[model samples]
Target: MSTPPRLTFVNRQGERHARKLSLFGLRALIEEMQCQGVTARAVLSGTGVLSKDFDDDASLITRDQRLAIYRNAQRLAKRSDVALLAGARQRISDFGIYGYALASSRTLGDALDLSFRHLRQAGPVLQITSRVEDGVIKLRSHDPESLGDLLPFVAEFWRSSNLTFLSRVLERPFPSLRMLLPYPAPPHWRAYGRTFNCPIEFEAEAMEWHFAESIWQLPLPNANPAAAKVCQRFCEQVLSEQPQGSELTDSIRAALVNRPGRFARIDDIAAHLGMSLRTLNRRLASEGLSYQSIIDDVRKTLAVEYLERTTLSVEHICERVGFSDPSNFRKAFKKWTGRSPSDFRDADLR
Candidate 1:
């Protein structure tokens, strides 16, 4: 049997994020359900996805088709919380596939580096860029279009998510967070601002963050060579089934990291990845994603982990997660979990 393209997903707030179908896996999932007499197509269609394209190559499916699958899956799953979970369960099998690699890293920063390296291989529509601006290292996003009118919502979530994780990883509160947005203001600002206690910048071009540069070089407290080897082995095993093509995500992740350095342009990322800008776009299209989507997903996962595990102030967490403002993080967090970060932390702690 021919191998299918890999599957990926982007976690969107309010609406289901996005999904990229793997022709082989999708077909298998559908076929298995069909044999069992389950109307897989009907179920998927109920989720707003058409199941016909399961046979298409990952590179062959249209954006609308992939989006439909995501929408349908979210609808079928009912709770937005379960969309990523269900999607991961079907396409990824073991959540440990990517988490395993992270567990193996020498530090949170290293783990983040590896995440960017293989983001598309997992799924998600957020890009993470960790760089040093002035003397501070900032973790931020490169795309604005993806956030849409919900840019504030997305940016706030990014803030909450990244900072929450950083506190857990560093065991200390960051000095401050700086958010970058293109708009003026929103009504729910106070909820986010009070929670974070950090200055919120507005009308900026991109979602940027600032942290002490020292953290970038800090070794991951959990960096274990044995663990990393184990995780790497697991990733290789699962990813082995994937066709051996020049990995585009690796180059894209690198560009995101090296930003404010040598690679600050998407064209530069494309050039470094050894494909034309158009080809890069086309290849990402095949996966049913844009480079920026994966970046945001990485940021969200990390941000949430921070929020849950650490006791650092919310504003500090916001900066770490790439939000220039604390209020934005609050709105985004509420959208993601239907609960504010403070409420989440308080409930979980209690």
Candidate 2:
């Protein structure tokens, strides 16, 4: 028998910009919170997300924004099973074209491989890796130490939602052999057993899911090579269009963000990055970006974040984004988003 490929998916937290995610997962969480009598406004607090944003199919949120919501859910949820219940509600339709690509694959193995390659399109919060050994497949989640206290909730949500997706893809309950989690069992731990239908072990050395290798070759009922090819192509295009960060750009943005209210000169950034100003310019040009462009992008992102997530005045925001003149900041903000800062904030409130 041919050996299955080893797959590792990493969504590290060090990227310059957070990964953009569809509102599907957020919508599911919001629905679950609503069931617990938690208002959507309460759930979306400090995330710069609005109820109206959910109505737009093309709306996307940054990873940080989503994390803000997750934190809110953790604090406001009245039930311990909120993450599990929210995750369980995920339908294949929630994944959009990514789901279609998985559903049309020839085999479960093909879908796994495709999903691993394009996981960014799926908006995972944790760094996950998988491997096949002997007669079993092991999937592991590498928890980011930065997640600290929020690890359990995020881990539960990720696992449950993924299992739900797998069940729909296989047209049967995904028979996980064993599940190991790094945290202590929650009060509603029984829901884990009911959802996974597998032996659960908490407070383990690592987070892992074990599966029998035979299931890898299971033929998908909706296998359509032509459709899969088209969907995969579209997924690839969407992934490519996503904003990706280079190491230098990430460092530069980190520096810029750390020192708000002052925009670093190109020479300063170049020196900080351990390169000459000319070299920095050349490298940025190679990546189709300019130093001023990055500054503008960063300013625009921060400006919008403040406008939506805070009640800061326009002048205060202008200073925070390194603009000395409020009028220039207003013009730049309008140019970037086609709305003045006040107008944008007011619209978000509605």
Which regions of candidate 1 are displaced past 4 Å? 1-97, 126-130, 171-176, 194-198, 219-221, 236-350
lDDT of 1: 0.50
lDDT scores of the candidates, listed in order? 0.50, 0.79
Model 1: per-residue Cα lDDT over 128-218, one tens digit each: 5455556665655654443344445445533554344344444454356555556676655554455445667777766666655555455
**Best candidate (score: TM-score):** 2
TM-score of candidate 2 on Cα atoms, chains taken together: 0.67
For model 2, how does the per-residue alpha-carbon lDDT over 6-122 read when each residue is reduced to its tens digit? 434545444415546767656678889999999999999888999998776456677787778899999999998899999988888778888889999999989988987777677
Clashing pairs in 2: none
Q: Which regions in candidate 2 have their CA more than 4 angstroms from the true location?
A: 1-4, 55-58, 245-350
Best by lDDT: 2
